[model samples]
Target: MAKPMRRLMNPALFICDLQEKFRPAIYEYPKVIATTQKMLKACKILNIPVFATTQNKSRLGETCEELGLDSPDGISTKVHADKTAFSMWTPEVRKAFADLPPTTPPTAKRECIIVGIESHICVTQTTLDLLREGHKVYVLADGVSSCNREEVPIALARLRAEGAVVTTSESWMYECMGDAGIQEFKEIAKLVKETKDSTQQSLQTLCKI
Candidate 1:
C-alpha cells in the first residue's frame, strides 16, 4: 500500500506524457487538462516541486498549455523533462529529479504524486517504476486518462494492485491541504471552485452534443 500523506513535505508532482497532439486521442481530455490545472494550483500554493515530461516532443508535441509547463501560474519552479522511455525513470528524467528545487532538501524521503496521459501505458509504467524505486506513488484518477475508456480503470486498478495509491484530484488536494485553517486552504478552495466551474461548463458543452 502507498504511504498515507499526512503533510505537504518532501513531495513532488510528476506529470507524464501530457502532450498536445495526443489530446484528441485520449478519453475525457478536457477534464484531464482541467484536473491537472487544479493540481498545479495546489502544488503552487503548497510549494511542491513539479516535474513534467514530454514523450517525444517532435511527434507527440509539447506538454499542453493547460498543464502550464511553458508558462505556469507564477509557480516558476517546474522541471520540463523530455523522454522516449515509457518510464519517467529514464536518464533524462532522472537528471531533472536529481536537481530538485533548492527548497527541497536532497536527503528527505520523497513521495511522488503523478498524473498524465495513457493510463494503460506511460502512466502505468512510470508509476510501477516509482514504486520499485521506493517512492510512495499516488496516481490521480481525474488527472490521468487513456485512449480507451475501459483501459483507464483497468490501468488504475493495476497500479493500485501494484501498491500505488489511486486517488482523485480533489481527494489528494484536500489531503495535502489537511485542514481548512492552513494557509493554502483558501487558495486551494478557490482553485476548486474554478475547477468546478470549468467542469460544469464542459458538461454543458457535452450536453449540447
Candidate 2:
C-alpha cells in the first residue's frame, strides 16, 4: 500500500520595507528584524517562496543588510522590488504571484505571511490588498511595528477586523506546516527551538499593547 501524501499549506513570505533608513525610527525595530530572521530561516528550510520590497530605494536605502536578501546563499526572494506605493502589493509582486506554478489543488489560494515596518501603513495596506484578492493574510504581531508603538495594536485590531489573522511568527510557522509527519517537520522544529529566546523577547517587546 502506498503512503498518503502530506497536505501542506501553500504559503509565501512578504518582507515589507524593513529598510536601513527606518531602523532608528521604528519602535522595537531590532525585535522585528529578529523575528524576520527566524521566519526567513524557516522558509529556506521549507522551500517556501519569499517576496521583499523597499519603500523607495533612492531615499530609504535598501532592505536591511542583515536579512541577506541579496546574497546568493541567503534568502532566495522570488521578487525583491522597490516601490513608491505604501503597500507591498505592487504590480511586480502581483506578477510574481501570477507566475507561480499552480497549486496542487489548482484552486487553493496562497497564504501570505507579512513581516515589516510601519504597521499602521504599509503592513496594514498589504494585508488589506491580499485579503481583497482572496488570499489568506497572516500579519505577525511580533514581526511588525511602527515609529510610534501605539499604532501597532490599533493597526492589528483593524486588520483582524478586516479579515487578516493577526498572529505571531512562531504560531504561523507551525500552522503552515500543519503536520509533524511531514519531511521538513524536524528541521522546522529545530528552528523553532533555536529561535525560542528571540521569539519570546520579540513577543514581549513587539506585541505589547
Best by TM-score: 2
**Residue runs of model 1 more than 4 Å from their true location after superposition:** 1-6, 72-74, 101-108, 199-209
Top candidate on lDDT is 2
Kindly list the per-residue Cα lDDT of model 2 for residues 85-191, writing each as its tens digit: 99999999999988988886899999899999889999999999999999989999999999998999999999999999999988888787777877888999999
Give each model's whole-structure lDDT.
0.76, 0.90
Candidate 1 lDDT over 1-209, as tens digits, reads 55343465678888887888988888788877777777777887888888888888988787887666657354554567788888877876777777775433555657789888888899999998889888889897777878877887788778999999887777778877666777767888888787887656534432222
Query: Candidate 1: TM-score?
Result: 0.84
lDDT of 2: 0.90
* Candidate 2 residue runs with Cα over 4 Å from true position: 1-8
